[model samples]
Target chain A: MTATDRQATGATWLRRNRQVVAPVLFLLPGLLFFLVYVLLPVAQSVQISFFRWDGLGEPDYVGLANYRELAGDRAFEVSVINNVKWLLLYLLAIPGGLFIALFLNQTVTGIRLYKSLFFFPFVISQVVVGLVFTWFYDPTFGLLNAILGAVGLGPVNVLGDPALATYGIIVAGLWPQVAYCMILYLTGLNAVDPEQVEAARLDGAKGWRMLWYVILPQLRPATFIAFVVTIIGALRSFDLISVMTNGGPFGSTRVLSFYMFEKALGEYGFRMGYGAAIAVVLFLIMLVFIAYFLWSMWRQERGA
Target chain B: MKTAWTTTAALALLAALPATAQDESLSGTLTIFSDMSNPAPRAVMEDMAARFDEMHPDLEVELTIIEREAYKTQIRNFLTANPPDVANWYAANRMRPYIEAGLFEDVSDLWAEPEIAENLASTKSALTVDDKQWGVPYTYYQWGVFYRADIYEEHGLEEPADWEGLKSNCQTLLDAGTKCFAIGTKFLWTAGGWFDYINMRTNGYDFHMQLTNGQVPWTDERVRTTFANWRELIDMGAFIDNHQSYSWQEALPFMVNGDAAAYLMGNFAVAPMREAGLTDDQLGFYQFPLIDPDLPMAEDAPTDTFHIPSGAENKEAARAFLRFVVSPENQTLINGGDALGQLPVNAASEVDEDKFLEEGFEMLSANAPGGIAQFFDRDAPAEMASVAMEGFQEFMVFPDNLDDILGRLEQARQRIY
Candidate 1:
């Protein structure tokens, strides 16, 4: 065919399939990235879990050995338990954020300043937050001990004690997470329908009754996002544990992510396959929540 | 004037001939990856590179100094994917993984040379695995009980001679409201130091080596005896409270402020203690007390080394660089008081006149007839060291948890080895 005929046919095809082609063309980069960076890595990690590799030499097939080892691994047990503590305590940030958002939502002078002040922790780096909390909980001369001393209580070494170290790190993690959730709630609060609130007020809905029945229902999207982010944040907690205690005081503060890093990339760790195993376990745990989140979103979209 | 110019030019040519002849074939870029990121060490590294570059005028020396902690993980990546001509690493089992993987070049021929054979003999075993030397030691520092001499004098304690004497001295310090040792196990490796010394002293260097080598079980009777010895100190509250929260540097304040009487640490602690205003009169060094006097004393003196990667393109230049690094002259210069402030690896190298270096040198050379260990973490496999150190930390915090900790370590030992 002539060049003009070929061009004319290509133009006609483009016009015919623009609807499907345009979206795919736009999504090509993102879809490629998602496949290469995320999906491929996840699959690779799962595959690696079945091998015995030190990241230096050839990988030997180990089958279920790594998983079997994890079953009896005390450090792995501690990390799983700490992760549970983190998950439960980390959810507290949602409510804490709601309360802070409520407290700061009022129309008052310098409200912007107050909101920013409350948002300050989220703006700061996680490492800084971890370091700040670490010093705050220092046994020797930390602000925590000084306050305890003032209140006639004995000095408590929070990070040093195995029982308390994980909780201490979770609390540090909560500081910024609560701020993040608060920002989401604050934005959600802004979009709340004032007309419905007025109708509720006319119907005698106020205070706790208005909040639970009227305001909270409007904040559903905010709460959902908060829950999703908080859950992911709790599972992926590494920087706080790393900076504050380094999964120390006998590996009490290790979450699966940090433990995975310790096994794969830490100074003493080159157990790539074992680390991949830990990563696989974490991925499976996350998958349950991810599936739930997706299903919920799908249902919500359909209902809308 | 003409005669004088010719004579001077001839003298310069004669002086340059020896160096240029030796390095005549070295022409390509020699890439070096060093973990000497600290300011002084970085300067020393840069100077050494410059000097090596000057010696071989045609060769280009490319030195990359990575942060020390980051280097630990980065070494694995670079050694495999993009290997350098030479790299810095610790000796002993720290090099074992790389050696076993055939990444590090076997430098046994360097050790066979008369100069290296005689002068660097002390550290030869540290660089050896499977009867082959893989690297050359650059510097090492002694580990001992750094203490407050003034406090010891006040308490009439004269550097304990035996385990009983050590315990008595500790008791004396404890009675005086001072913790006997200031240690931070937050990083976990500090606890390894204690385990090394106590195990080395309680059993012997050979037994300690066996335990670290994974030949002996973690739950072995000898291992328990070592922990039993360590438990005595823990039970006595010899260590500082909440040490698990502090780093090795943070624990320094306890010793500096006289809250703790002593610290069982490497010679590097001397610099910080001195910086913290502990004068020579206040600070003192003593070999770890004799636990089994019948057995000779072994000391933990971790040696830092340089190795040629097996995949290096310019190994001839790398080999020459390694020789220059360990040569008595360069060892002396690099490990001088103002430089690394550590003990020179070459025996022929003159030690700096610093008091701690002198004492450490004397102790390591003459007194430690048993053996010289490369610290607990260095001597043991990385995974095993990490697991055992964590156990050590747990033991320090809760002496009652020894049985559980040992069981966990035993499991790790089996899995790792």
Candidate 2:
């Protein structure tokens, strides 16, 4: 009686598990594609960092020689420092965007259109943004210079001056980033609990105190997304640098991403080995921040 | 289950495909990776391709006209992977690394053909890397000062013969409210042109040779003197500011609209000028004024060439195309047009009665004292070229720091060699 009952139970278990089995079968195809295209290439790039190879021909095995040389490269050092500058300055966009979002949050005829119009720069390619800013910075016949002349202030060489060029490019980069942050804030603001704001006001909370106590805490998710994107965008600053300056005026605008490109592919001779070395170094540095972010997310998840 | 079976079937089909994709025959399609994307050259090559197809009906020539900047990256990638049957490159040092790596086919045999040999006599050495001819010379343009005729007339200026005269002409043009010169150094090559001319005039041919060859130190007095002349031009307000922000093509409008009186540029600028609505009556070309008049003229012209990649699929077709490109008939077709604006590399190509061609022809035949390659940047190794240009730009911006810049260039040269 017991054996027969056990057999009947096993048959029922197999029938019920068909639903799970079918879903797993469907998931396999997509998971394989994701593994092949995305995960594999990333793994390969990391693996490649350990060897010295040009884009052409076979790669030779090198034991951390590329990393050793990168340590001594002054240009590499400059690129890392510039990357830090880009990261810090780029975060300014989130606050700036939030401020703009709050200002334009009201409904006053065509407000939706205004929001979309303000978001325009984010949609266009960064290459186009770089070109527009390059023209804007042109010392002669540029809008900036024309304005300077009108005010009787002598012209300032924004791009040509090494001290100002990186900052100038960062400002151009921020134009679109701010728009992105603004949209995130606007979405977060829409979801803010209205009853809580009313309660805070009843207790005399207003302006900065009100924002700090109630509004800011509610915007955490949006700010978190904004901070992550801005940091990634700042670290991966290549297209704009390539288009605007090609790391020119003596490599003054070179960030790590652009420097990696120059080392690997640009006219500086195909030092793919040297370039991979640079990439590995860049990856390790990026890993530090990424690891910290992962830890933070894990703690948040545990708390939730 | 259905999707898995489909994927497996697709993979099986792909794996079963033949290795070679082309049809079985001597006359299959041949692809060309070319940077001559301008409509004029595209049309000329298309016509030639059609003609070649007619002669060899079985074989087809497929020409891909890529943009200049993209083409550089594309060609490098192509050469590394599935290289096109034929491709274009710069002669001299630009082709050196490719030649050294054995990436290009040695086409010395093609040069032995009488017509090809005779035609490339002037630029044969450039195409000949390490005593082996790796490519065929196609088109070349002479570079110098191109100015607005109307502005020069209005300012009572004639084409200057010496450095001082050129300086005075610039001053007069500036005082008259027209920008004396329009330059776009944003691409970095334009600044190299200024350095080349200054060095060519002051140091003459031999030093120019030594400088590019890395036989002379970049901090040498001759090199410093050249920078000093360039600095003088900058301080005098003889050149426009923000030259680094615009490309040469973007800056052409200044000269076209009479905003700038002159452009120190290659003969290619003439075509762009015409495109910008400036007529021959409004535009004129002159040799860069010499600091020492008696110094021998060494040409600063750059030549365009083509090479067959080592791993090219159609080696025979590639050779045939190279031969046809430098053949007198095809050379005439390329050089006879108003668009190309250059002397034919092939000697036998008749200069058609085209007026535009006449100006370029006269410039090449008369002004060339001896054929000199462009500048140190093009002639030197790519690494050295990058550093040297950085030094040149720095010196232009901060002339008082000449010692520091020259010292840097010297160190860079040492690092390169």
Candidate 3:
């Protein structure tokens, strides 16, 4: 609050600005690209939901009609319910990944290679993942059936059965998601504050409580990132659904995004307006979590 | 340093110039986009491209094959920016939308070139929209019941001639502990084939025309009766369980193994089954068992056609390509592929005596009935086809709800225009 502090702060700002301004100019291209590609399309997609048009034709204003249809659409309702199931179940990957990461975090021979090998599923394309799982779930020639036969159980049509089809796809989706979370946790574990762990060990703190009190708190940022990515992955799920079942068995496995695509461009119809309406609902559901995350980040920034 | 640099530069320029010069010719580049990735189709297309280059000696043809399921979205995107000069497209309803958009070139002039128009008569109907032909016909296939001759022989049965015969045959097959029919409705289009044939047989030609044109109500008793017939087969436990997960190709093994008696599929299925080791003598072809013998028979076959895009850089070359495709020599090569199982669209184009195609030719050629029932999905717009096919699947599974399903289709019909 003093005149000397103000003068010193002013001097500091001027000196920093002289150095920072050039870097800011250098940063402009990437920032502009991010705004254009990411931010602008999102805004436009929200705006487009109010109108009706096939991609080729002129769009007509149809306030709330698309939304009204979406609300009444039994398929959309089913899809939204499936998406909720995906979001809830997808979080299991974090703990599963954390355990795998911790198990492999030690400095053993070829451990670095082991960690990379563990992350292989994450590196493979989702299409390939979907194909692999589809084969695994194939009622006749799949690994699941072969194993079940050995156990004297009958063959179960996993993907063909409407009730089990979504779960089958979800299991396939989880394979890569778990690998992704493992990588995040491995990186987080590398930065875990070994000095505090050693200090706590000297005080006879060894197991879950010691880890919870000291090591876990330090892994918050990594856990937060993992949680956010997993949630987003669940919400944005489409490729596996498209590849595996294609929302078959009487459209049992349709998630919201795929349902939106079906509404718009699928053989079903080019109900682009209705698709946009479904998309807007998905976006709003996502917005609640995004807003909470943003608010949390903003509070942290303010506190810092 | 300057002398050494100049010598190296001269050598590099000399090395590159011939290749660059060779690249700058019309005969040097040929690009294709297609959605036929079945191994046979892919091999056939590539071989044709290589052969074309060999004949031209200058133009290099590059072929790109995409999976069928992804073709529509990929084609839509490609057309938005740089449409490929040539691509595979369906004959009727699918082509009509793109043609209306001026996305396809009117190859009517090419059609007039005597060699083509006279050759591909059956397919020309599918390719032409509003009196202008948009594409050249490559292949047209007949849809019917492909049965196991051996199985029928073992069970003391013959190819069904009418509804009663079909029902009796089903009972005979079921009593033998063999699945009566092997159907895979996973794509939903397979069921459309069943619907198209059944409706064609049940209501005859005029009724089908009226139903497809959206002039007649789907809930009309004629259509309901078709559902009733389909439900009888379903209730008898004749179809394979989990039929929804199996593609037509995947279901062939069941028929070949005697797990099923017959497959209601297009003629194209024969090649794959033959490749899988079934012989000409083992397979039997039949008209879909007639729902009503007195109601005249109509062929429910589909044609595959090719159209040039509107903005093709080489217009004359594109026309020449169309003319070449429809040429008698080329149509014969196309039919000769054998794996294609299609009758050449042109009358003069000879059948290869490839057993299955011969059978298709005989069955398809007979009867002074109406025009071909262009595969249901192709005859109907894509949106309506998907809805109706799904409705058909539901009706097959839940026959009592025919009224509700048809009523729903009536609502969907209202939205098309």
The candidate that achieves the highest TM-score relative to the unseen native structure? 1
Candidate 3: docking tier: acceptable
What lDDT score is found at residue B21 in candidate 1?
41
Off by over 4 Å in 2: A1-54, A57-65, A267-269, B1-29, B352-359, B374-377
Model 1 lDDT per residue over B140-256, tens place? 999999999999999999998899999999999999999999998889999999999999988999999998899999899989999999999999999999999989999999999
* Candidates ranked, most accurate by TM-score first: 1, 2, 3
Residue B174 error, candidate 2, Å: 3.3
User: What digit string (tens of lDDT, one per residue) describes model 3 on residues B290-383?
Assistant: 6777877888877877778886666555555566566666677776755454777777878887766877787777752666878788888777
DockQ, structure candidate 2: 0.34
lDDT score for candidate 1 against the true structure: 0.93
What is the per-residue lDDT of model 2 for residues B68-134, given as tens digits with 9 covering 90 to 100?
7677767778887878888988888888877766789998998898867877788888787778899
What is each model's TM-score for chain A?
0.98, 0.89, 0.88
Second chain TM-score for model 2? 0.88
Q: Which ten residues in a row have the lowest lDDT in candidate 3 chain B?
A: B18-27
**Candidate 1 displacement at residue B133 in angstroms:** 0.9
